[model samples]
Target: MATQYANDIPFSASHDQQAFKLLELPPELLSLLESEHPPTLTITSSKATETTSGYALLCHGDKKYQMRQKNTSNPIMILAPSRTMPTESDDAETFISSPSVTTISKIEDTIELILQEAEVKAAPKNKWHEKFAKSRAEKKK
Candidate 1:
């Protein structure tokens, strides 16, 4: 009876086809799918080689996606979020909470202070000497 039940279920190539489909998807499409499903995602790439390089697989939501790059030079692709400046008419002030806004402002002020300190510390004390030495060396060459 158990053997009969096992035989009753027919194996289909759908899963294999699905796996193949997953491999061919781009990172953008994979990210969109991951955002929608919120599944565990894993990315793997082939080791540096002549022909096998630039091939990467993204595994997520029980599906695998394959991506091939035009060249093997760039092993990793990074997608950065786009930043937009808020206009006067923008309703971001209304949408964002006060606490969050305050936190963001504080962070920005801290970063600005750190950058100012870095710039002050990085200023060359012997700027004239360094520039004159470089120019003298170039004239000699």
Candidate 2:
């Protein structure tokens, strides 16, 4: 029978400590959290686990929201108000104001309008066929 030694088991607590540290909210996010006051928002940096890729956690009361970066190299910031629910946690004192449906709809409409404007601005000024025709006419002259 082979004797198993304790040293054979690779047990280290450093990884957990590092993961906890990684989850610490950044100062910029904290400032935004204070300014926005979205009922409750807790931002945390996540490490890739077995099931999913690394993502940021945005907790609003008892409800949890995960924010996955579309591009690992460049991450975009998104701010959205969330409804708060009472929880039996130490941070239960945090309260959030819910926006009315009308307000949300107006915001959505404004965003759609802005996106339409941007699309219009980004469209090509001259069509390829038009340019080709103009060049052909010039060559004929």
Candidate 3:
């Protein structure tokens, strides 16, 4: 049982093998899965060869949101925190965490930074400055 948070990355509940094969799981998710105390509920799974856009799993205490296209589905599902039910004032105007562009962008940026760190750690000899130096040398040549 993992502590699900708001604005967390959403995951698709796919059971198809093809979906997982095509879905690009962010490095962060990979890292989480590898962690010793990974959150069981936050784990993502897919079924189709490719992932679908505009979908995520909203998990609260016991509520699970299943938003998907019944016809053609993809595996690029996200694991996000559950949102409160919409109210009259919140209808189409209020800004809550759901399938939104801003939230997605933030998640992507965080993933990129995690990946950069991982790369740097994996390649101790090739620092960012050293890579820049190599590029400069090649350009000069």
Candidate 4:
């Protein structure tokens, strides 16, 4: 393999860090996304209860997939590149152009989707009697 090296160009990290999430889509999820008019997916977390620590899930339509964050030893960075135009020097004698890249965000972990059973569960029944419930009827005088 031939190796070529280019001159070092300056790259800077942004002052403000924007935390980014990396999601690894599974095959089932990929197919859903490729289909026409893909359903909207949402990330939701369950409230922490006495039995379980809060867990997150990726919801696609009525289907829900368990989302797990796996930490990585190396950090993944998202960068934006720009080519700066040549500007006049302090002495106004020369023009300097710098092509640079900026690190806009960093991701340390990735979210993995665990495929859950995609069963079409029955729609939930609404308790109409519970809402606007009637008070107890009065006894006969």
Best by lDDT: 4
lDDT of 1 by residue, 49-92 (tens): 66655556555554545544233332332222323435577787
Backbone steric clashes in candidate 4, count: 0
Q: What lDDT does the true structure give each of the candidates?
A: 0.41, 0.42, 0.41, 0.78
lDDT of 2 by residue, 57-115 (tens): 56555444455322233322233344434446536556543432111111111100000
Model 2 weakest lDDT span, ten residues long: 106-115
TM-score, every prediction: 0.21, 0.21, 0.19, 0.63
* Model 4 ranges off by over 4 Å: 1-6, 45-50, 84-93, 118-141
- Candidate 1: pairs in clash: 22-64, 22-65, 23-65, 23-66
Pick out the ten consecutive residues of candidate 4 with the lowest summed lDDT: 132-141
Angstrom error of the Cα, residue 36, model 4: value is 2.5
lDDT for each residue of candidate 3 in 5-63, tens digit (9 for 90 to 100): 74465443324322122223455555765799865643233224355543344232343
Encode model 4's per-residue lDDT on 52-140: one tens digit a residue.
79788788777788898899999999999965555454444464657889899889999898866865576998877655354322222
> Could you give me the TM-score of model 4 versus the true structure?
0.63
